[model samples]
Target: MAGRNMNVYFQEETYSKIKNLVAKREISRFINEAVEEKLKQRQQQQKEELRKKLIVGYQSRIKNKKLQKILLTYGEMSWEDLSAKLEEQEKNDDNCKK
Candidate 1:
């Protein structure tokens, strides 16, 4: 793929290892591939962490008595109607807080 040139610094030992392990001219490609892989791994790790947090949040909400009461009161409504009711309630709440 086409790319731009930039400078990157590596510690002495790490630099020496890469230089010795890769073909002299392929150092840039080796580093680019390594960086891309590391970025992908980190992004995947972050997504998994967020998913776990969301599950925890949802579990906590399920255990809330207030939320349970609200759900029970609105549960009989159609999903679309219930959403509208909840949004209206939220707006009323924000107005009250002000």
Candidate 2:
């Protein structure tokens, strides 16, 4: 509380809502608690989004490996190309692990 000073402008209806919520209690404390809870919710949402992206990427990788196997069996690609691709994939995996 002592470390922050900020201004926020709200519509009349929104201001009224906030006042109504704290009409029978300490307004400052109520607002502080509400803001804290909202920040926590935002942080949690960001974490969940990152987790979902990682899961999708992992699934897509498995699909790519399957396709590569099919192509290799049909002799549609060269060993040199396959080896290079494997090296690139390894690099990406190492980056993700870090």
The prediction achieving the highest lDDT against the true structure is: 1
Q: Roughly what TM-score does model 2 have, to 2 decimal places? A: 0.56
Best TM-score among the predictions, by candidate number: 1
Clashing pairs in 1: none
Can you give the TM-score per candidate against the true fold?
0.66, 0.56
RMSD of 1: 10.8
Candidate 1: list runs displaced more than 4 Å: 65-67, 70-98
lDDT by residue for model 1 (10-96), tens: 999999999889999999889999999999999999999999999999889878979789778877789899889879999999999
Which residue ranges in model 2 land beyond 4 Å of their true spot? 23-25, 67-98
Global lDDT of each candidate: 0.92, 0.84
- Report the Cα RMSD per candidate: 10.8, 13.9
What's model 1's TM-score? 0.66
- For each candidate, how many residue pairs have backbone atoms clashing (under 3 Å)? 0, 0
RMSD of 2: 13.9
lDDT, model 1: 0.92
